[model samples]
Target: MNGFKKFLFRGNLVELAVAVVVGAAFSGLVTAFVNSFIGPLIALVGGKPDFSDLAFTVNGTKFPYGGFLTALISFLIMAVVIYFLVVLPVAKLLERLIKAEEATERPCPHCLSDIPIKATRCKFCTSDLATAPTP
Candidate 1:
């Protein structure tokens, strides 16, 4: 029970659960957007807003290819929205955060080569830096 509890409350498990919930919510919103707005735009071009209802009968069997098309469009729209909205912004934020830290890197005293602030010895020049103070 203790081990199960630990696993249940683990950081990754919680994060994944949250992610799944958010993703489901986002998917719903995207689906709504496509149905409400994009569907009309599609209707303007074609009589049908969604292809889900458009199907053909073959040998008295219905092939619902329209539903597949609708699902495909939904998936594509969701992917585009996630990439442009979430992924791009998050990546830019991470890049900015990393750039700030990278800008603070100190150079090696002996070789003038770039080194981390906490580095005690210069990797480029092999300088012994026993007395060197981190800035």
Candidate 2:
């Protein structure tokens, strides 16, 4: 029972669960907004937004291009929202974290080359320098 609780509530698992819930909620909002507002607006401009009934006779076959258009729009909206809301912020946050890590990993300024954090001298340049004490 304890093991199952731990497994379910681990830090990463908790975060993942929260993310899933938030994502679902966000998806619902986007879908609703598109259907109620954007769909009608687009339909007003372009005529009949729901294309499931749209058919074109090519030779003897009917091609449903309206459904394809709706699918394409939904895919585009999903891509834009995911990219702008999730991917961009996550990438920026990761970049900031990497920069913070790299700031500590860099070698001494005088040497202008990579050396251990505790190193007092630039190994390649052989220049003496003081290193800040590690707390």
Candidate 3:
């Protein structure tokens, strides 16, 4: 019982729950934005973009696929927004924090290995690079 309490209240579990709640809230915002703004724009193109109204009847049975369209579009927009707004910035920040050696360092002439700038010798191949970095 004690172990179960510890497991339930673990930092990762709590953080995950918080993230899920926040994500759901953000998704609501995205849905509202898409429905209020983008929906009209799509309606202009698709003729009544409220997919809920767009439907078909098969053997006197109505098949409402407009709702599916709305949901798919909303989901796609949410994915794009999250990717660009959250994932991209985080990735760029981490990249900046841990700079890649190859980006700033020069490639060795002999072995094509990455080495420090202004290095006179290629550490990987032990080749003289005094004449490297040709003008």
Candidate 4:
């Protein structure tokens, strides 16, 4: 029971659980948006909002292609939203953070290793950095 409790309360595990819950909630929101807004927009052009009824019979087997198309559209919309709203913004923010972090460090010319910007010696090679070129 102790091990179980530890596993349940582990930081990464808890974070993952929260992420899954949030992702599911976001998926539902995207689905609702597709159903409420995108469906009507498509209907304005296609004359129908619901596509599940569209099917074709082949050898007594029904293929619901319209439903697949509707799902595809929903998936595309979700992908676009996630990419623009989450992925792109996160990427840009990370890039900015990396640049800021990089600005605090400089390469040790003797060892070709990273050292603090104000470092006067190369920790790796024990070489004097007083005359090293500054980037």
Candidate 5:
């Protein structure tokens, strides 16, 4: 019971559950967007709102390639939306954070180790830093 409680309360598991829920919700939103907006846009250009009815008969067997095309378009749109709206912004934010963190530290010249920017001595090599050139 204790192990079960620990597992249930674990941070990673909770985060994963939240991510799954959010992803499902996002998928619904994207699907709706594709159906409502993208479908109409494609219809305007291609004269068809959907490709589900498109199929080819080969050797008395039918292959519906249009559905595959529609799905592929939806997947591409979702990829682009996620990349521009979510991934690109997150990457930029992380870059800014890394720069901010780097600003608070400097390399210890004598030891070539990272130390506080204002440090006057190299803790690792026990070398005096006052005479060292600041890069």
Candidate 6:
């Protein structure tokens, strides 16, 4: 039971929950913006751009093409906003942090092993080499 609890309530789970909440909030914001601003603007230009009404009946069923377009636009806007506002910055920040964590002082050219940056000779082989940046 303890192991199960630990597995279910890990850091990744918390992060996933946060991400879901943020995504929902962001999607809601984009949908509100599109409904309030873009929808009216498009309606003004195209003469009543309500997707719900811009459909046709075939046989007995109506195909809601305009609603589909509205949904598609909302999805696109949400994706673009999340990509630019969250994913890109977080990826770049993680990359920089990883690079900083992996950085070393230097390495010995003689033995091709890690050594102190200011060392005059390779600690393993005891060979003095020209002072230069480690490859």
Model 2 regions lying over 4 Å from their true place:
55-68, 81-135
**Candidates' lDDT values, in order?**
0.81, 0.78, 0.81, 0.84, 0.83, 0.78
Q: lDDT for model 6, on a 0 to 1 scale?
A: 0.78
Q: Candidate 3: RMSD over Cα atoms? A: 4.9
Model 3 vs. true fold: TM: 0.60
Best by lDDT: 4
lDDT of 5: 0.83
Candidate 3 collision pairs: 51-66
How good is model 4 by TM-score? Answer: 0.76
- Tell me how far the alpha carbon of residue 124 in candidate 5 is from the true structure, in angstroms, after superposition: 2.5
Tens digits of per-residue lDDT, candidate 3, 1-135, equal: 999999998999999999999989987887787778777887898777656777999999999998998778777876887788779999999998787434557888779898888788888899998785732
- Lowest lDDT sum, 10 consecutive residues, model 6, at 102-111
For model 2, give the 10-residue run with minimal summed lDDT.
102-111
> Residue 98 lDDT in model 5?
84
Question: Candidate 2's C-alpha lDDT?
Answer: 0.78
Give the per-residue lDDT digits (tens) of candidate 2, residues 1-135: 999998987999989999999989988887886678767877899787766777799899988887887799777866776788779999999999986774444555775677776777777888876757343
Flag regions of model 5 displaced more than 4 Å: 93-102, 131-135
lDDT winner, 4 or 5: 4
Tens-digit per-residue lDDT, 13-112, candidate 4: 9899999999899889877877788778878998987677889999999898988977777788778877887899999999999878647778888788
